[model samples]
Each structure stands twice: as C-alpha cells, then as structure tokens.
Target: MVTVAPTYHVPVLLRQSVDGLNIQPNGTYVDVTFGGGGHSREILSRLGENGQLYSFDQDGDAERNMPPGDGRFTFVRSNFRYLTNWMRYYGVTAIDGLMADLGVSSHHFDDEARGFSFRFEAPLDMRMNSRAGMTAADVVNRYDEERLARIFYLYGEMKNSRRLAAAIVKGRADRPLTTVAHLTELVQPLIGRDRQKKDLAKVFQALRIEVNHEMDALEEMLQAAVRALRPGGRLVVLTYHSLEDRMVKNFMRSGNAEGKTQQDFFGNRLVPLKPVNNKVIIPDEEEQTANPRSRSAKLRIAQKLG
Candidate 1:
C-alpha cells in the first residue's frame, strides 16, 4: 500500500489508473483532480526529463501539497471544467493522457468545517473549491421545494425525495437551515433508525452535487477531454457514484453521454474514444480492505481514436 499523509487525499486505483494512461516518457499529461497530488506524483515518476504535466484543482489547499521546484509540473488553480481553455492558454493543443478522479476528497470529509459529512455539526458548507460557488447551506435554505425534490430524486436516487424536500421546506420556513444539524434534525423523522446514516448520506450527496454543479461540470469536462487528447491518447476516469459512472461509460462507448452511437450518411462512425476494456475495472479485495472509502470506485479507461 502506498503511504500518503492524512492531510493529502488518498488516490484510488493509483497504479491501475496511471498505468492505463500508457505514459510515453516525453508525452504531456493532465491530472484534472490533483487533490493530494498522489496521481500527479505517480505520473511525474514515470515521465522523462522532457515530459510535462498540468494538474488542475480549484481548491487552494491542494496546491500546498504540490512538489516544489518541479519544472515539469504546472498547477492550474481552476475547476477542471475549464480544462481545454487552460490547456490552450498554456499552448498545449493536445495531450497524451488525461485522468480525472471525480467526487469529494477524504480531506473534505476530515475537515469538519467543510460540512461534507453529516457526522459533524458544522455549518452546511460543502463547496469543494471553498473559495467560490454556492454552499450546501445556500441550496437547502433558498431553493424551491420542487427544485430540491428534483435534485434529491435525480442526483441522490432517493425514493422519498419529494417528502424529504417538503420536510426541508416546511422546517426551514421557521428559520434558515444554516447548519448540518438543522437539516439532519428535520429529516430524522423520515429516516428509520437503521438506515438513518445511509439516507442522510444520500441527501447530503444530492445537496453537494447541486451546490458544486458537479454533473454539469463533469459533462463539460468530458467534452473537453475528447477535444484536448491527441489521437491514441488515454482518458482515465475514476467515478464513485452510479450517475458519474454512467456518464463516463456512455461517453467512452459512443462519444456522447446518452450512450447512443452516431453514424454519418457515408456509414462511418463518428466516435472519438474506444474503451480499453469492455468491463469496468474495480479495486481488488486487498485495496478495498485497506481503504474502505474506495469500495464504490469504478475505473474506466478509453483511448482517443485517430
């Protein structure tokens, strides 16, 4: 097992994901989710002296973990949604590989003030960047009950999303739901004692997705990944939830998130990426035992076609 500091986020499928990139010693690479620089470090180790790496992270804390005096690595402090723009700005038109480890990091959960975990009684602020963007508190306190219900249903996959949204709306009418505890208390009656934690996690996931605009950002990033990768270059992604996994899988198969292939009038397929493996890659039992947080991780690797 690779050792990483608690403050630095532990990367899932570290070897498998990086290896999937099929790194060329002098090729250019991008690690779009440079949370703790674990994946970026692995990529750097494989690079030749002439190789270049561009790692993006909107969180300021992540930059602190970057290796100093590394002339080959450039850290971009912006959301991965602007990946193509930044790459172009840096005069990089095409890259050899790109990797994105989606979703919240372990550091976010460890920091109680972030409010990513319901186990803590902190302010309901779950912004990954934390420097900008709306907080979870803002979404819960201000969004219409219908909008909340839609997100809970679609993002969280909760069956009782409407009831949950109604409960929050009714509860917050008395006062603003400013903290994690406030939201938890309002939803407690609807949650059974046995599934309280799981149900609460679902609601929190929905709120975080909405607050961060994760789905939209992910879709934009995928489109950008296709444009930014060179022919035969790899796009490796590690997704934690079914929604994210579905998007990655569909895009890999059809070059679109809808999972449908498009053919031209000349009977030629227009897909950009071909799956490295038809089946999803998952963590082994040993890795899972070591890091339970990686249990839900699904890795998908695809290569850009010429």
Candidate 2:
C-alpha cells in the first residue's frame, strides 16, 4: 500500500462544494476533479450502500491519495473533459450531481520537479498529465511574439503583454529558454519593481494555459457536464481565476457558448441552468488562514433546468 502523504492536498471549498451537490443518499454522483479525494470521501459519507461515486483525476499522483475502495467508488485516470464519454463507458447515462474543483493541486506545486511554483528553479514543465505534449519551455521558446502576447493578454490578462513578449523574444534570441528561472529573469525587468512578481506570475500562467490548452479543455468539460446532467441535476464548479469564473458564470446564466441572454417571444428567459446563488462564494477568513491557496477560489453552483 502506498503510504498517503500526510499533507497531500487540502481540498478548497470543501463544505461549499459538497453542499452544493445536495447529495442524494442513493443517487449517483461524479466528482470530475478529484484531487486528494477530499470531496469524494465526504460525498461517500452521505451515500447509501447502493449509491455510486465516479471520480476523475488527470494527475497520476492523485491515485496514491485514493481511499481504500469499497466497490461504491470508481476512479478514472483521465481529464474531466471527457466526463460524458467516460460516464457512458461506465454504463451511467445521467448523474444526480457533478462537482468540479478546477485548480492546480497542492501536490503538484509542492513537488519542485513538477515546476508549477515560481518559488522554485526547476524545468519549465507544467503539463498536468506528464505523458502529454509540449512543455512550458517549448511554448516560451518557439511561439512567435504576437502569439505570446496574445496568450499573455487573453489568458493572463496582463497589461504589459507587448513589453513582456518583446522581452521574452529578445532573451530567447541568444539561446532557448529552458527553465522557469530563465523566463522569470527575462520578464522581471520588463515588469519593473511594482507588481513585478505578480506580473511574472501572470505571464507564467498564460504560458502554462497555452501549453496545456486549459481554456479549450475547460470549454469541452463544461459542455460535457451540461449534456451529461439530468434536467434537475446540479453542476457545481470551483474556479480560482477570472477567466474560468467568467466562463462558468456566463454558461450557467445563458446556457450558450456566447453567453448572450436568451428570451422567448413572451420575454421569458431561455436559460437551461439556473444559478443556485446569485453571487459567487469565496473562502471564509478561517479557511483562508488555514490554506492561502483557498483565498482566490470562487465557488458557483447551478441546477440544470429543462
């Protein structure tokens, strides 16, 4: 038996997310992003013997954190982007509730070799699934300046995207940038003293997003969640960044890709999902004090409507 790390992961918004599911004792459920199985274990506690839980985690390391199986739980080692297809493969048509906690796992950040944290000088790798495509170095070194600027602007929402891109281009001209430290040094001067670290974080975030195709994966997962849910099933998502939160907010409100509000001839709304709460939920002071990473988290819940 793999000894679970004493400090594997502290799932953010634990109460909020599990409560958001409104779990039914005998009903089937899915935790699309099962980091450390924190929410999954909580959901299992409330489930009856017949109840079933399907959990998905793309990171292979998460498998080590899995609780001892009891035939009631199933863990799928794949991205949540294929939620619908995977559910079908398991002979499940519709789930009573679905929970997705989308953020970098604490394990990933703590493992320096994974290279997620800016605090460490490690390889530029940021692939959630190590088996997959290009690393962050490939993105920084190979992408054109305009493309880099666009990623930084759209994903990171960086204000000095042009300057940052230019700096990267210039820095890489002499030799290919191959590590997180290399990129950090190149962009820090362009960002200057005020908010320099934060700016560099944004740039790194953009690179990681582009390298992993996070936005596109999120879109695919959202669409799959909507289609796989029953009419009254709930879709609860916890997002840490504005880009993801915006997409979730719009999709829940409009039930369309464009996020445009729809109305019938009688001026009735055509939204297929209704927000359980009008406002997003943030971590309480207590939670934030315990886990700083929980500070930026935003939890949003919606119930699928006919």
* lDDT, candidate 2, 203-255, per-residue tens: 77787788778888888988888888888899999998889888889998998
Model 1 TM? 0.97
Residue 285 of model 2: what lDDT?
98
What is the Å distance of residue 196 in model 2 from its true position? 2.7
lDDT of each: 0.92, 0.86
Alpha-carbon TM-score of each model against the true structure: 0.97, 0.95
- Error in Å for residue 300 of model 1: 0.2
Q: Candidate 1: give the clashing pairs.
A: none
User: Evaluated with TM-score, which candidate comes out highest?
Assistant: 1
| Candidate 1 lDDT tens digits, 192-265 | 99998889899999999988999999999999999999999999999999999999999999998899899999
